[model samples]
Target: MSGAVQAGYAPPTGPDQPTSGRRWVRWLVAATVLWAVLLAVLTWFSIRDDPPTVREQRSLAEAGPVTDRAVGELLAAAGDGGAARLLPDVLRTGCRITPMEDGAALTRGVEVLLPGDDARGLLQRVADRLPASWRAGVETTGDGPVLRADAGEFVAVEGHATGADRVRFTAATGCRPVGDGYRPLAGGGGPETDQATALLRAWGGPAGQVDHVAAACPGGATARTARAESAPAADRPSLADALAAARGGAVGVRATPEVYAWRAAGTSVVAERVDDRIRVTVTTGCDA
Candidate 1:
């Protein structure tokens, strides 16, 4: 028989050759997939300047993956080392702080009270005054961050006769809530007292009728940038409009920019003009 009759038969490819080629292709695809996954993870977790303490964590979110130790550290960063003195709740339950992976956090918070004032002052001011035991449970998550203080909690201070109701007063400047139950925020050298005589008559003074004053001086915070203060207006503009425009969050009504008198949910916010500075006074109790 002739040995040259194999024209229709296809030559077999070497087993090693086919196997090596398949392996190389599979490896290439896997590498590509892994690279894509890594990129996505990095982008999601790219929160800059991780907050160092519980107080700092509050400035971020309220239901995320923050650790207690990290929250404490961020709060410390904002200068809340003595925050428990004012907040009071932290002493009992400590706080949690999670960093934001997305970049929207800077814009979502309460409006910065003044163009000159920003997050830094607000955090520092709030952090410093928080009662050592004042901090409440903290939470941070995909939505945002929240540091619950005992502002709304009825607590007896040394001087007040009636009592005090500290509230969640997130403001622009660093001054605290003062007056009947909030705080006395004085800018450009003003009186550090509340003018609610009716409430006072019903209540009393800080030592007598007053309860506890609330302020925010959260530590480890970067100060807000300063911008030119808005000119004073005889009739305060619509706070709803202003709030809609301002980038920061709930600035203390006592903030300096322009005394903006307005109302939110039936709450009266008074705006006062002092020389070139504008101060807004609000009966702050913003939990909403």
Candidate 2:
């Protein structure tokens, strides 16, 4: 019989022909996936440390010197430190400081009574006192202009003058401004409390007369304002006399240099000289 060819039957040649196109495409896909995964891993590692950015570092650095200067100014104004004694009388009198001690922390704040209604001038004066490097600026808040030193040891010194001759100044030593002191949790006690009671007694303010007011203070401190009246001002002991008596009774007394004011525990007593009479205001939660 004669061999007849099939219509479309083709014999295979050697081994199967390689699928080059599909193989190349698979390899290319694998390589791309591998490269993407490698890139993602590298990116994650690069930022894993979470180091401070340039902006943050600059801010922190700028704040350090500014805060230090503010602290120095506060110390000088307070007149309690050895450095304060060296300062000129004019600079020292620009403000008065009251120091509060909490555990191992020692913090001081200032109270300024400016002469005129130049609230802006007062703010500018304080800003000028800082080193030129601080680049102090005044930002207007609801109350008044708040002097701010960005990235500093002392964050801000804020004050306001509603009118003329009624300026109130306060300084914030910490990174954040103190929001009317720590909120009082509840109750009150400690040797400080006892001292406060004794001081009030020395001032002739009956324990019954101590009225409580809502106050923001550490440990939920309750504010008390004790007023001694219905008697001649002369009959009442001056703030100095009361403080002396209190100190003699073994009460801790921290007095301003002028001797017209003193603080015991968290209580503050100020003797305001008006004409020939002196009015005494005994208040608790003073630094709170």
Candidate 3:
């Protein structure tokens, strides 16, 4: 009777007293789990839109060199022609990136003035000459035959006929961030300058404001092109006759009333009449 409590009396310490502590511990564990899950979700959202790698995040300025090299490769592939005009400005304007959630892209190109009307044949030749790694191939589209390939480093190359006498080749870089501003590299005229000058004098007279663009060739050499325009001389012979005479019976690559293309001393020379003025272009270091 001394140890036994009465019916209405009970001990203060019992199994139920420990339940509050356990409930507090459970609440703490749930709070920690929720916090961890929230942090993980936030981290995933922050990175979901980022580029997969740094290579894809290049800016226009950063990708300029790659684009220029690609241009060179295109020119080299089509170098058999008489003249090539680098379209750096077109690339700059076409690839100008605008701010967006998905970034932007870049592209560069060149125009080769080809003689003869066999545009498809010329494209085939260019495709065959492209680097084996490029996997160059020709596809006939509704417009015409097109040459498409990859220039490595995620750059793409394409060549298509723009006119009966012009074929354009372009290199493109896929989507990227709009990085720093782009400035074209300054290039000096090579020996081609003198060749262009001579052709200009033969075709017209003195040229005004000659422009030049240079590219790297396959053998660590530099390919240079010089362009100029001047008023046709009234006393000079016709472009075809003049170019024919200048060629010295070596056979002209192209001859027409408005345009003439020929090779002189390892350089390609092209003279074409634009309105009343004749434009002369000379290219060197891409003969091979």
Candidate 4:
């Protein structure tokens, strides 16, 4: 007998394989295809379920920086009079832009006439359509939309209507209060009138004319405050300017808890620091 060693049944090392090996390869290939299919399904659903605002961000990002005119267009679209009767008697709209590190934040406010329950639904639709990035709970709020973004800062839109079905729509990039409360636009009844009435009453003064300092641009007796929205942050008005404005006339400066206030022409003008900017409020002794 020849002394020879015998080799066991060795598996094929190249592309060619035995029946059992081929079966194993087929199973692996099937498993991989299934995993890939499942992953694709998940991705599709995720994109499909994304909120409309997310898509808005993507589109706006591609379009570049937002402008005040762009913001006005949005507010005008949202304020379509046909959806609900805009209470011109009480309708008020305000737009302001605040400076930021990278760019500026533009905000617009519009007060409308709509029932509370109905307005919530309408504003929800508006919120869903907004391009501003929003907070988590904004999607589920009983009020309206509260949006925030790092590109500028927080932007909020809130709708409130009492049983009278009178709603105030306020949108802001900063923390300033919007439409302190609803008032009729007719009969000189509005934010400016109300502010003047409140301030004069607090000062225990008689009704008299009020005027803004010449240095205050976009100023009027009706506008309690004016912001230099067009200027850069560093170029904006400072606390000294506010103090100077309040002390321009026969008035004395006194530090109040919330502001530095003075009285002249039976009116009270107050100034205070809001973040890095200064806000000057001119309160006239107007009859409410």
User: Which candidate leads in lDDT?
Assistant: 3
Candidate 4, residues 111-150, lDDT tens digits: the string is: 3333233645555554555545432123434554343222
Ranking by lDDT: 3, 2, 4, 1
Per-model lDDT: 0.31, 0.42, 0.71, 0.37
Per-residue accuracy of model 3 over 4-95 as CA lDDT, tens digit each:
87898876867657667788999999999999999999878766875434446556567666666767777777766645666544442343
Encode model 1's per-residue lDDT on 69-164: one tens digit a residue: 222333333331111111212211122222422111110012223223233344445444455664543444343334444321222111100111
As for candidate 4, its clashing pairs are: none
TM-score of each: 0.21, 0.33, 0.71, 0.27
- Model 2 residue runs over 4 Å out of place are 1-72, 75-109, 114-121, 137-146, 151-157, 162-199, 206-288
Best by TM-score: 3
Judged by lDDT against the true structure, how good is candidate 2?
Answer: 0.42
Model 4 ranges with Cα > 4 A deviation: 1-19, 50-225, 228-258, 261-269, 272-288
- Candidate 3 vs candidate 4: the TM-score winner is 3
Better of 2 and 4 by TM-score: 2
lDDT of 3 at 165: 77
The worst-scoring run of ten residues by lDDT in candidate 2 lies at: 82-91
Task: Give the Å shift of residue 253 in candidate 3.
Answer: 1.7
Candidates 1 and 2 compared: the better one by TM-score is: 2
Please tell me which model should have the higher lDDT, number 2 or number 3. 3
Tell me which of candidates 1 and 3 scores higher on lDDT: 3
